[model samples]
Target: MKLRQVVPWGFTAIVAVLIGNGVLSQLTARGLTNTVNEVMQGYRVQTSLQALEQVIVDLQLGERGFIITRDPDFLRPYQTAQSNLAQEFARAKTLLQNEPAQLQNLNELEALSNEAIAVLSNNIARVRNGETPSSEELIQGNQVIEQVRVKVAQMLQAESQTLATRKDIVTRAEILSAISTLGGTLLGTLLGLSIVGFVIRQVVQPINQVTLAITSSSTEIAATVAQQEHFATEQATSVHQTNSIMEELGASSRQSAEQAQKTATGAQEVSQLAETGIQAVSYTLEDMSVLKAKVEQIAQQILHLSQQTDRIGNISELVTALANQTNMLALNAAVEAVRAGDSGRGFAIIAEEIRKLADQSKNSAAKIGVLVSDIQKAIAATAIATQEGTQTVENSLKTAEGMAQTFTGVTTAISSVALNNQQISLNAQQQAIAIQQVVSAMNSLNEGAAQTANGISQTKISTQKLNEAALDLQAVV
Candidate 1:
């Protein structure tokens, strides 16, 4: 049959056999094997110790050869021995980590090696110069070598006994460790097989069913989300329409407010015009008053001129009376001359000349009266012109006053209009403020709507993620 089909039974038997040979029942056999292995390792250690001892002997021989024959060929063996000695010492140290006494022996060996180096150097120098070696020095060096060899041999025998004893014990321990490891392996294998069977039968089938259900639910959710997208589009269209209507309303309100403001400004200009007209009328009335005062002064001058004309007329009448009296006296003198005859003729002639002089004076007085009468008539005419002028000025003043009154009425009407316009302006300003408040509220609403939309979008994304997480957990379960 197939090896996979045979593996479980075959492995079981192998595990059973290993457990039978293990430490649970074979302590004595394990101890013996351990003792044998320790003996073999100790034999290796002893061989290394012997090699170090031989290096010392070679070094001594090299000294003796230099001292006796003075040959460089003999020193070659000494150098080789020195190198071999270092190698052997390192090998022994690594192998004898638990042997404290052997390490002490190694320290003593190092001292001997150093002594051999000194002795060889001296002997070589002396022999090369053709000097013969002393027998006593050669004998002493040989004795040191022999002693070192004996000590190495002793250390080797002792380590060999210890290694043999430990080897037997190690052999038995190895058998027991093999048996225990085999028993653990068999138990672990059975448990692992049982776990695999349980996972396949109990966990995998249910998880597959749950995954199928979750996939069906996710498909339905996708259909619902497509419907929600259509709804969202309609909602966005509605919001846009609402925003457009609000913009129209805001524009109309702003236009109305501007028109009202223009009307108020026009009313204010009218009021200012009325006030200016009243001021002009007032100035005209003041000028008319000045003209009336000047006319009154002219009338006074005419009255004074009439009084002077009347005085001149009276003086002319007095001159006429004086001329009449002079003529009568002259006639009386002529009558007396007729009665006196030839003796009164010269006096009569002088009286006749006086009568002519009186007549001329009378004529001059009459002319003066005419001149005074003309002056009086002219004064009366001037006075009449002044009266007419005064009446005209009075009429002008009255007209100016009436015009002023009309201007005042216009001013009053303008003031009423200005007050009404101020009220209208205040109402318009209040309406504009109300509209501004509405605009501000609309802006706040727009901002809030944007924030709300963003929050809703984020929430939708988070919900999708949460659904995914639930599906993942459902899969895991």
Candidate 2:
């Protein structure tokens, strides 16, 4: 059966046993009181019958004294006895009213007493009137007194028998009350012990078993959560260190790329200056060829002037010989005119004038021969200087062509170094992006581990509280 039904029924049975014991005790007490009261009434009835017999004896003594002395003092006792005897008989009749046999005895005793009193009264009146009474009348009065005494003895015997019967009934009621009280006490004690034992077996033991299992399970769960939280914290720290290293590498790569760009710009400017120098060298070579041709033409004109001065020297020598022959002819004509007298004098004067003209012609031919010899010496020095100037111009044109070829090779090497720097910059940017993603994921895992640890701690506290409550319930039961 369920505990709900068993507990109430057990209490009800205990109450029923107590009520039955109380009712039985009350009934036993009431029966003993009633039997004692009836025994006391029987004793009162026996006392009243004995008092009636005493009153009858007093009447007989008073009558005997008055009849022998014939005195008035004796008559006073007789008169008193007569008055009290009727009252005693009336009291006896009232006490025995429930007993039919005792009442019949009292009636017969009343008739005998009346007859004795009448006999005594008649003899007393005869003595008072001065007459003598006969002996047979006195004998008849004595017989009646004897009959009254016999009837009183029989009534006293009947009261004694009734008193014995009432005592026996009181004894039997006391015995029955004792037996019933002892039996009820034993039955009630046994029933109460049975109810107590049943309750301990059904309720308290099962609750203790369930509480112990819950405390053990909560302890294990709390330990597992603590270990997981420690692992997550360590992982987050490692990810943060990796992210710092990636940022430093990216900064260095950008600086190298900028320096390479500056070197490429300087190389392009040098290539442009070299092309301009080659154009200027070609123009200088053309100007030296034009100057060599002009020097050759001046040498040919000086040679032609030297040949014309030698021809002038040969013509001045022929004029000097003709002037000397004219002077000798004038001298011979002057001597022949003296030998002939007056006719030869006129011919001598004409011959003297011809001799003066011939001397002036000879001096003019000598000055022309000295001027032609100086002109021929200057033409010979001009021809030697023109040949040396033509050899120096040919050596300068060959050196300018070799310098132009060296500048072209330097411009090609600078362009190749600039292309390699751009590829390194691109790779650094991709590595920085990947490191940032790893740092974000580690932070999320750390937060989840902290929340799990908090939940496990709360569960452990609740389990402790439940264990305490179970212990309190065990104490109460």
Candidate 3:
């Protein structure tokens, strides 16, 4: 027989039983574990506390034994008490197997207690054997016992903290689980009752609602499938874009590094050009020195011209003496010319014109002398200017050489940079290629993502429709 036909109620009963039992079992385990942990933790705390109490009691007893009896045999109980503390310590250690801090405290207490016992034993023995007990010795014994008690108390506080933390964690976990189980039980009971009610209502309701719900679920599944395909396409596109950008960046970096190397090279070339220009300027200045000496010789020629002018002035003075005699002679000639007037007039006119010509020649000579002096001065100035010009030129040449060297270095550096840039471009190309590959991969991934999203969308749509159909059934049932 089919399961639903032969034992429809059987399956329901089984599910209810399983769910109820599972929840109950989980709750029971949580409770039981909490109980066990609590018992173990409490036992440890109690054992540690009992150990501390025992130590305190033994300390008191030892003090009393020495005080009252003043006998060596009285020290026996104190000694035995010290020995018995080891057993109590062992018990605490065993109980605190998981409580390391408490066990450490127990060890310290044991040590302190033993020390007090030994001191008390020695004192009691001394007194019993005929020495009187001193007040100082008794006080010292009390102090040692006090120290042990303080340490035990501190340990107890630490253990209590640990217990509280454990208890809180257990309580929260158990309570939460109990609440969950209770909620589950309530939900299951309501659902079971509704299902029974639904069967009775189903007999009267039309079946068309079921058909419509199934059709709607199919439509939702188809829509989900379409969405998934679109998502995959979008993912593929994004992947491609990312890959392309990475390739571009890698290429650009390589280009920049190359450019820097080229610039450094150009700077070195510029430095060399500056040195060459400086050397050329030095040579031009050396030629200017020779030209300056020639200018100085021209100044001496002007000085000679001045001397010649002085000689011409002396000659003009002699000519004037001669001219006076000639004038005397000319006067006698004019007397003769008066006897022969027309012929003499022409001679007189010629004499006047000759005198005027002599005067003009003397003036011209003086002017020529002045002109020579000026020329000499100008030559000197020119020579001075030439010398200055040579120096200026020399300085300018030096500057030019310096500039040329700087420029040459710059050019060389620029060339190198250009070459580096070329290399960078090459690297960029490679990177671009890599990026293209990445983009391709991303595209593939995006396609896959789109497919996955499409699938998820389809699944979600189908699930939603199923849920809707389930809701619709609620109305009939």
- Backbone Cα, N, C clashes tallied per candidate: 26, 0, 26
Q: In model 2, where is the ten-residue run with the lowest total lDDT?
A: 413-422
Tens digits of per-residue lDDT, candidate 2, 377-443, equal 3334333333333333343334334423422332232233223223322332333343233333445
Runs of candidate 2 with Cα error greater than 4 angstroms are 1-11, 126-143, 203-477
Among these predicted structures, which one has the highest lDDT? 1
Cα lDDT tens digits for candidate 3, 1-477: 221232235324424543453445344444535443564455346545644555555555655655565544545546666667777777777777776766777777778877877777767667767786688887888888778868876886776566566656645554554455445444544544554344334512422554465456546544644553344334433444665454443344344334434433443343344344335435533543443344344335434543554564455456455656655665665566577665445444434434443453444344334433433343343334334333433443343344335334433433443353344334334433433334235555545544544444454444444445434433332
Error of 2 at 354 (Å): 99
Choose the strongest candidate by TM-score. 2
Q: Mark the regions of model 1 whose C-alpha exceeds 4 Å error after superposition.
A: 1-255, 428-477
TM-score of each: 0.37, 0.44, 0.37
TM-score between model 1 and native: 0.37
Global lDDT of each candidate: 0.55, 0.50, 0.49
* Model 3: per-residue Cα lDDT at residue 294: 42
lDDT of 2 at 146: 78
